[model samples]
Target: MNVTVFGATGAIGSLTVAELLARGHTVTAYARNPAKVPASWAERVRVVIAEISDVQAIDSAVAGAEVVVSALGPSMDRTATGLPLVDGTRHILAAMATHGVTRYIGHGTPSVLDPEETPTIQTRLIGLMGRTLLPRAYAELLGMTDLVTSSAARWTIVRFTAPKNTPRQRHLRVGFYGTTRIGFAVGRADIAAFTAAQVDDDTYVGRAPAISH
Candidate 1:
């Protein structure tokens, strides 16, 4: 697979790129600062310098690639909003459509899934707070989902719950949107491996699934 990964310098993005390359897939990684990529990856995979918000840049980066994966995230700041995640996703989808690339996998938070499941009180409280307090980020994430799934493309949105830097494990749990039970913490490497697996799995297309240990 000729995979193009946006946010290749980010935490989960870099892991996804490593997993793809370890599988012997040719990867083109898009990063704003190419120098931020590890020396090993810089030597192994093709690195393209570009911002995800730039449509032309994205189109060129993913050209000739079969799968486009995005792990883009917005850093939290009081003065900042989540426009980067929302707008960057729109630009990525537009580029994919224009370039005739149909397959996409995106990183999202598990918190945005609709609460149809019988979740623990702790999880339910968190959702309520997100809806009432962090509405901007919540709305942005939901909007991204709507754009990706509605587009003329095959897309899987992977929602994750985890504290940072957890260790990888086989047989990680998957919770589909609206399913019962909240997912526990999962490792970053596990998330990468799962995304890599989804490259060929049609089962997850147009759906959102939460990943955890």
Candidate 2:
């Protein structure tokens, strides 16, 4: 598969790129700073530098790619800035559609899931607090969810809770809307592994899988 990963220099993006390459897929890592892309991948993959929010730039970066993966978390802690998530996601989706690319895997927060089905009061409270304190982010994520849900392409929105820095466990628990506390905590590598896996399988297409370790 020829894969393009947006925000490829980010924490999760970098790992996903590596995993994809390890699996022998041709990977393209897209980021604003090409220097941020690892030197090791320089020879094996193509690096495209451009702002993800720019429609033309995104279109060019994803062109000719079989699958698009987005790990586009805010560069900085934006709990206070309250930047928009859906707008960026919309741009990516639009770019993909324009380029005639269909398969997509997007990284999303667990807070976007309904709180009623969450495992414990703590998880629900945290999600509620996030919605209260960072309403814009949550709202935009909701919009992103709606867009992906409505899109005609094959898409998987991987909803994850606290992302740990631990090593890859190679284990994951996946659940859809009805599963409570499906995604409580997961390692970054584990998330990357699943993301790479999704490029080949349409198992999660048109579904939001809450992932946990």
Candidate 3:
């Protein structure tokens, strides 16, 4: 499979690129700073430099891609009001549609949904942060979700709790969370593996499943 990964320099994005390559998929690491990608990947994948807002750049980057994976989010330098999630998603969907690319997988936050399991104190605090302290970011993510859900392509938005830097467990609990319970902390490597696995999974297409270890 040919995969184009947006935000490829990000923590989880980097791991996703590695995981895809390990799975023998051709990967294009798309980022604003192509140099940020690890030197080790130079011989393994294609690299494209472009801002997510640049539709033409994105269109060109996604050309010939079989699957598009986005790990885009607000940078710490910017506040929630400046998030590129919504607009970026719109551009990605448009590019995919134009290029006849159908599979779209992206990362999302658990704050977008109501807690179905008994809320841990940590979960409650995170929810409060998203709804109260980071309302703008929350709203932007919701808009991104709506855009993806309405798009013509097959899409899967994997919502996760806090992403940690721990080593990969290779074990994940996947659920809609409306009826099932998952953990609150997941390793970044695991997240990448699960997201990459969706490239060939139709079960989660058109659905957003929250995952945790």
Candidate 4:
């Protein structure tokens, strides 16, 4: 499989690229900052450095990709400007359509509720905090969520809560809210593992599962 990763410089995204490589998949890493990519991955992965808003650059990145994973995360910065994540996702989807790519795995929070779910305590608190403290980002994430779910592509929005800088918990509890017991925190490497595997796994298509340790 040819997998292209957006936000490849982030903590989880970097891990995802490596995971894909380890799984014998060709990976094209899309990152804004070249310095953030590891020196070790230089020879093993294809690197694309450009702003998320550059439609042409984004299209180029998704050109021949069979699977597209967006590890683009939201920020809590109140001053964070614009809907770059949402808009960049729109561009990615369009580019995926331009080519023949169908599989899309993206990241979101529990605050972006799945249609079948009722709000849980964690979701309620997260929603309250997002609406109060991170209004712009919350709105933007919702927009991004809308685009992915409503798009023509096969999309899986992996939702989570606290992402800890811990070792991979190979065992994970994954389900929608109110349906299963899930913890508030999870390991970043664990997230990368599950997300990268989605390229070949169709079990979660059209569904957003909250994953945690």
Clashes per candidate (backbone, < 3 Å)? 0, 0, 0, 0
TM-score of 4: 0.96
* Model 2 lDDT tens row, 1-213: 999998788889999999999898998888888678788985898888876567787777788999999887643345455445567778878878888999988877665553234345554665797688666666666677777767877888888877999887755788754544464678999988998889988877876777887
Clashing residue pairs in candidate 1, if any? none
1-62 in candidate 1: lDDT tens per residue? 89999889888889999889888889999999867979987478888887767778887887
User: Over the stretch 1-213, how does candidate 3's per-residue lDDT look in tens digits?
Assistant: 999999899999999998898899999888998568799986788898888888898988899999999887655433435657689889999999999999999878775553234455555666787878667776777788778878898888888877899998856888866466678889999999999999977888877788888
lDDT of 3 at 55: 86
Pairs of residues at least 3 apart in sequence or in different chains that clash in candidate 2:
none
Q: Model 2 reaches what TM-score against the true structure?
A: 0.86
> Least lDDT summed over 10 consecutive residues: which range in candidate 3?
114-123
Q: Number of clashing pairs, model 4? A: 0
- What is model 1's C-alpha RMSD? 2.6
TM-score of each: 0.87, 0.86, 0.89, 0.96
What TM-score would candidate 1 get against the native? 0.87
Candidate 4 global CA lDDT score: 0.91
Determine the backbone clash count of candidate 1. 0
**lDDT scores for all predictions?**
0.78, 0.77, 0.83, 0.91
Task: Kindly report which residue stretches of model 4 are placed more than 4 angstroms away from their true locations once superposed.
Answer: none
